[model samples]
Target: MVEALNKFQLIGQEQTRRYWETLIGSGRFGHAHILSGHSGVGKDALAFFIAAALNCKADTKKPCGNCISCRQFLNLENQALQLIFALPRRSANQTDPFTGIKEKEMILINEELAKKAAWPYYHLQIDAANDIRIAGIRKLRKDIYLAIDPGTTRVIIILRAHKMNMEAANALLKILEEPPAGTIFLLTTEYADRLPDTIRSRCALHHVPDLNWKLIREDLLQKKGVDPVQAEICARMSMGDLAAAHGYAEQDNTFWLDRIRATLNTLAKEDFVSVHKQVLLLADKEEQTDDSRQQFLSLLILFFRDVALKVKMGETVLWATQSQQMNKLFPNCDSQGAIKAIERTKNALERKVHLQLALTALFFELRKHLRR
Candidate 1:
């Protein structure tokens, strides 16, 4: 059974793989397991792999992904595997209200699965009420009580488990307390603290760590077919989050990079013209989305981090292509100041403060750091 974990293909988190393999193999596997970690880490992926391995009929090569059970799980088409995720309840414009809401949710969930099938690093995005409602859980409770095909292990994965509504969480807790034999509950969450203590206590907990930069860099190049330099950049920017690195590679990231470069320059020089230009550009289509804005801010943080590296390790910066700027401003740039600036900007955004004003303040503060 331990050998099975070594055979698993999950990148990074080797410890977690071994632990689960041992638990399942020893017949000590808990009915519920909680995979807790940062968003975009491989928590969901690891959970799915464990579920697949448990359900597969392979004798030694547990998830010999070639088997029917393994293949179905890989495709997320396994009848025994149930995937649950948050979907907004209903839209204001939903006409039928009852059927329309359920139909819409199903459509969105199918779309999410399609994305996952095509891109292994996809994160489900539900536009409406992003919480698992009691209705879904009640149905699950009923379904789990029903019959199971003999050798088929029923594995239910509740993704973004932290988003479960209170009622849903309570309902799930009851099931966890007395889970049926051959049924497994795998819950993945970025915020395990939000789960009730009773729910957390019922499940075996696995902490998923971020993949290291080297692994991410190699994965991006080998698995994702990204070019060397761009792959390195994406991996560095992603900071061990493969999902984000893949997204950075898939999109024409230059759109954001160019703006980010411009903004960085404005911050360095306290240039009124460039700052004003950025405000208008960012307010428009390209930089408007929260994802875009967060990416932009993350890039800014990385840029300063590179500046710090440039000062500490001459001729070496993460974004080697941006060395000219790093040399120009960050020769004496305070790393603490850069960190402070990043914290301020991140806090402002998290608090839902005015984006433009927050960014304006960030630039002003950054100017002091780079100038100092």
Candidate 2:
């Protein structure tokens, strides 16, 4: 191995690794740091690695995974490592005519923490209790001021830090303002913009980049043992999400591809009626998974993107990779219209626009460009 195992379970995040090595190698590191990036980009893994490295007893290179300190950190058994994540007040399915399930909520959070200890990248994707409450923040505040672990540095890592409610954020800001010596606060968030400027400004922020296609390809082939052709397709579609790529490798996207091809047919004929029907189908699908609408929209965008690229760059189509004549099917398509639709739909969906209205407007715009 060219690189010594630095204790981070998550790989491919070069920026975080380089930053940790430099910080620890020079013996100069900050008290607080923010690891910001998209979800599944391994922000949590990076945090655990940094914490372990800081306390490792390796005489030369730090985070020697074999060292006793590194072992404790690896198992997440180190007392100096304080892990905090979002815990909601109740379950998302709690549609009961009552509020407050604090006990149940805490139990679920404990389960999530255990899962995280086993797999640091484990995201408590349970949307219900997804916030770092004021209570957790207060506990952190109390714990930090207490006596330090004699031999190691204290590492407080707050996963999904963006989930902190307003009160919790304020409480955290105070701790970040006047951080104690020998204590490092590692905060990880998928949405840094959700955090207030005051809290953001205090920490040394590092934006972890999305995983590249090359990295995903290597992982798919070597780790998952996926066939080369399918691996290429999965790598293409994952859009820098490791988890999504893994899912694509393991599961068939036949339904997803069929939907994309069906939508492409509507666009090919400039059939406004059919386009509206597709919108209706998507709107209906959203009921099962609230974000299914966006996922479908993402599929559409990819389709349009592939078509546009085929027209412009002569690249093989993703949906019809084997068909050399596929580009001809979209001769009347306005490349500009395709571009506009991708951007407009993406922006509208992100802003939480109503699906029917957004898709209706987009289809009309696309029809106008494609002609009569």
Best by lDDT: 1
Tens-place lDDT per residue, model 1, 1-372, is 444433334677778777777887898777888899876778877877888888888886577777888777777888888888775666433222224467656787688888775554578776765677777787788778777678888999998898898878888888888888889999999899999898999988878987887788788878778666567668767877888888788865555567766776676664687886777676565638767777777777776766666634343334555645666656776756877887777777877887778777777777777767
Give the clashing pairs for model 1: 88-128, 88-129
| Residue clash pairs of candidate 2 | 88-129
Compose the digit string of candidate 2's lDDT tens values, residues 249-335: 786544666676676667666466898887787767444354555555666666656655663333322455522234565456675
Q: Candidate 1, 28: how far from true, in Å?
A: 1.5
Worst 10 residues of 1 by lDDT: 91-100
Q: Report lDDT per candidate.
A: 0.74, 0.71
Q: After superposition, how far is residue 126 of candidate 1 from its true place, in Å?
A: 4.0
Given candidate 2, what's the lDDT at residue 69?
74
Error of 1 at 131 (Å): 2.1
